[model samples]
Target: MSTVKDVTFDLLRRLGLTTIVGNPGSTEEPFLKDFPKDFDYVMALQEASVVSLADGLSQGLRKPVIVNLHTGAGTGNAMCAILTAYLNKTPLIITAGQQTRDMLLIEPMLTNIDATSLPRPWVKWAYEPARAQDIPAAFMRAYATAVQQPAGPVYLSLPLDDWDQPMDATDVLRTVSTRVGPDPARVTEFGARINAAMAPVLVYGADMARGGADVWADGIALAERLGVPVWASPFCERPPFPETHPQFAGPLPPAIAPLSALLKGHDLIVVIGAPVFRYYPYVPGSYLPEGAELLQVTDDPDAASKAAIGDSLVSDAGLFLKALLPQVNARVAFAGGPLRKPPQTPTGELPLTPAAVYATLNALLPDDFVLTQESPSNIPQLQDQIRVRKPDVSYAFASGALGWTTPAAVGLALAERQSGRNRPVLCVMGDGSFQYSIQGVYTGVQQKAHLIYVVLQNEEYGILKEFAELENTPNVPGLDLPGLDIVSLGKAYGANTSKAETTEELAGAFKGALDHHGTSVIVVPITRALRGLLG
Candidate 1:
């Protein structure tokens, strides 16, 4: 019989999981020894960065990636990234090493007590095989569960001794189907609502992006054909519709009242791929306008069940949109309310406002550049000034995790490079978020990937300040962060760095960095202003 590690490699190869992202330790060393020459192991400085890097690669490559982690401590460190992956529905095959089976009951130093439950709720499935022979079966099940509809991370705990034991051939050869189609009846009823409504609106989210460009084009066709205004889902990190399209309404606000206000006039609302709505600040409002009806199409049953005001159909977003398109009538002119446009703001001197910074970048944006953002306080202004004309060109942290986008951008850049795409990756993150995974810059520098990092150094927790203003609370504690040199930090990480305080300076720095090869960082010091949900 072949050894467990050999069979595990075969199974991974069969599943096309050839890349591994991890921050390894003593417990994981046995499994990683003499790692196969064909496999790529991407290492990260921290466990959080490891999982997040895999998250981006998985989403970018449109497949699952394997993640190896240490015992309990490493798993604990990676929990936040796993949560982010869960929220984004990214497929991650997360495996953790455990103490030897012989020593598990005796409570060896690094044993993961109750290993099976350690990554629960965040993963689709969690397991620690009862016997060494069952390890291959556990991984097969994990792969299937992770790639299935409503895909998310899956975890497995393998003891150090397990990798040396004999494996079962049959378990490694098992295969499973992953894709699921929408119910025909529910799809027809959904089409009927679209056909009958005088004024209908479409709200879509990241799930649509996961369906590929064909699905994105189909969604645009369906919306245009139905003459419905399209709104990106509230708090969505993905671009479901082209932002530059004339029919495109802006993003739905995270606040309940404004969101309700925005949809008040639409007679029928169809929300696809997103949760009903994700809100911030406790604002009370009706779930829907008095006479309006809501229908949601999603792949996750949990999202459907937890939604506040819609009847939901569980289905793949792309399949549902494609099925519904043919049932609608001829395209009608948009007769609903006027679409919202970003307000024009003056670009004052020296210390530029957030809007001005966006304006400068927007004017200089390259045709082949991709943006990964994490500057929460500046996002509203950023979205207004900069527009994504296509799907898969922009990414952000849907889970609101601070460190995700910076490292994720690196992974995306690597994937884009490996795929022979020449797009330059741009990462815009707040200074506060920058520190969370700053070591990722070292990876980008070492890999010589094409990337530009823009740090919005505002010297305070601006989003929290805005929240304070919204809640009418004064003298909030721990809101100010003064005098941190992000440019120096970038330079220390081997990135060519510059700081800009004026619009002219910003434009110069941006132009210079974009023209330079490899990775560069441009830090902009801006005035801290609390606009309170209004951007």
Candidate 2:
């Protein structure tokens, strides 16, 4: 006489989705009722925060995490956050409570009128179970869809009244292969293409970073043996290679013209684990330099199909690296300016510069600390100043969505505790982006997630203003954001707060926050300067 909830709980327990993450509503109570004592529930005040938090947790754990949302309203709230999860290639099983089956004829209040379609184009699969007895099977399908290659979030809507009406729950678990072995012929062909190119470059993307230490070693081996320069993919959510390495060229500009120009001299561009290009602000030009050819290796078939210019091989990044490594011939040495010239260090006068802020952070931060960045205006500055050398230690919203980082930081801190890694987390956010998921501060405090938030208040949407200048659009209003008191906001949520306007103050505040085992916000007012839209 096992109920649907009972069978589902057992399945969830077996799946290691024992810790449920989300913001639930009345419709969800039936599924969550008398929540199992062995399971834990992580709640967020906003639906968007919940989704992103789950994303971070999943990425940190390197596993599929389950999240619960309230039917239509919650799903809508989390749509953009869900998109970030999708682009990040993080595995997530998203479940929503639906209106009772009996009430569907009348379309009752809180009913997900179009539940199945609401999260479309972002989620891989979205379904509302046909019957109460089918809930457990639907969950199984959702999990399988989510964790498969090109891992991403999948959705399932369960009617509120369906939790108790279930019968069979005997044998439902199945093992599935999450990685695809590289085709030996394709691998040989890809290696041949690499070996044929005279002047080649490697562009590492987020998925390569997702492979952690083992894959990073293989990537380094491949690059050194090929005697080629390495560039991180533009606008990558996670940088694939160590920034401070000798062969590292700086990040490729995330615009069409500039990206093409940067790769102008290179005859072949080999992109691994990232899109061929991810651009913003519509920079039109050739997809590649005049004589250059492009090859993309990625797990996501969608990325390969959508690439504007590239020969693609769909394979697991780690396996592809290992398979291709031995076939390529070693070169004497890369014969060009192997690394791109870095921008000159900024000298500060009175108001703070973006580079100065990042430089101070870089100088003072410990090597082991994790950085979650969402400061859009200062992305290039931070990437240049900060060296991301470790795998799964740096994260940004792949979808270019704000509000995901702060909550993500909290979730990552929680994951660190669970894994006993317990590396301190540092979240760098723009003041404008901070307010988008400000409620994350409360969640951090409640969950005892020790994270330090460094919010740079530039008194404007600086990146947008840069975009305005580039796009030559006149009189775009709402570009300036003024009168935000992040210190007060942080304090209201029971977090330790500080304001650091000077370098000395910044160092002290950062150290103090780092030493404390709780949530802290260090707000800094920075002068606005545009580094161009592509940066």
Candidate 3:
């Protein structure tokens, strides 16, 4: 009989999870003992950084990545990033160590408080196996659940002593359940609606990318046939359509009310692989435009079952697009010119604006580079200023969480290196958010990853300041951070660093940093007034 470790390794191999991202601890020693030579473990300093790094790797590699964490405390530390993964719909198999099986009733040291329920509402599934022999099968279940429709994180709590226990070799890995496509008639009905509508708008969501490039092709073909515009979902992690394509309308407004206004003239709104729309607080609006119809195609049963306002089709986005392609007309030309450009800020001798930084970066950066942005104040400005020219090159925090970009940049760089791609990874983070996960730079240095971290030192919590003003309380406490040096932090973490006090300095530093072989940080000195203006 093989030990549990053997079975676990076999299951991981079968699932193609050869690379493990983790922050190991004493409880995980048994599992780490005799670690296989072929398997690679990418370690981080903290559990949160481990999860964020895995999030980026999963998006960049387009595959589920495994992450390991120590029990209880470790899992607790990683919760925020886990929530981020849930919102982003990134596939991850996160495993945490539990106390020895016999110590459950006694509550051993480091034992989690309700280990099984720790990641509730965040993970698609969470389980702690009853028997040591069941660990491998539990892993299989975790993987299957994570990669299934509406992919998200799954959790498994494995006790330390269980790894050395006896387990059957024949029961390690099992077949995953097959996914069924949508009804042919339903797809046809949707296609006909698009064909009949005068001005149909195609709202592409992260699902298009989840469905793969083939699905994107079908979506593009259908959109072109209807002569409609394709708008990417706000806070989207994946490219919904080819950004350089003439029919692309760019990202939809982050605010639902404004988005509704923008879509007011369109007759039909066809949302595929995304929610009708994700909204923030105080964003009051109906789901659809006045007198406009909503149609949705998705593989997630919950998404299909819960879509109250739209005609929901329970099917794979890829299958729906493929079947709907032939039902629509082959060619319809768009009457409008390319999307109207937003006005640029005047280039006066004032402190460099977020718009200027975006414009300059957009002009200088390579088209194939990956960008991870956390400068919330500059989101709207960046959207209008820097346009993504290629698929798989742009990313933002879909979870609306801060402290995500820094670690995510490391993961993106790792993915590029693993895939044999040479394009640089860029991260733009605010000073307040940068402090949250600045430790990630050490991981980048350890991996020798090529990434340029751009710190937009705006010296305050810009979003909170905006919220305070909106709530009629202008003076708020704990919103400002003065006299902090992010460049020194970067240097302490083993990264090449630079400071940009002027536009010329910023441009030169950005170019030189991108050319560097190892990780680098370019800190831009910005003003407090620059807050709440970017997004």
* Off by more than 4 A, model 1: 168-171, 335-338, 342-346
Q: Write the per-residue lDDT of candidate 3 for residues 467-494, one digit (tens) a residue.
A: 6765568667899889997888889999
**Candidate 1 to native Cα RMSD, angstroms:** 1.8
lDDT, candidate 1, 354-452, per-residue tens: 888888888898887788888888888888888888888888877877888777887888878767886888898888888888888887787777889
List, residue by residue over 1-535, the lDDT tens digit for candidate 2: 8988888899999998888898979999998888899998999999999999999899888998889999899999999999999988888999998988998989999999888899999999999988787888888888888888899999998899999885876657777888877889999998998889988999999888888889999999998898888998888888798887779987888888889999889999999999988887677899899999988999988888999998999998999999999899999776665475564587876478877888888888876888898888888888877878778779887888888998899889989988899888999999999989999999999998889999999988888888888889969999889899889999999998999998888889988998888999999998876777765
Query: How much is 239 displaced in model 2, in angstroms?
Result: 0.9
| Candidate 2 lDDT score relative to the true structure | 0.88
Q: TM-score ranking from best to worst? A: 2, 1, 3
Positional deviation of residue 203's Cα in model 1 after best superposition, in angstroms: 1.1
The Cα local distance difference test for each model comes to 0.85, 0.88, 0.82
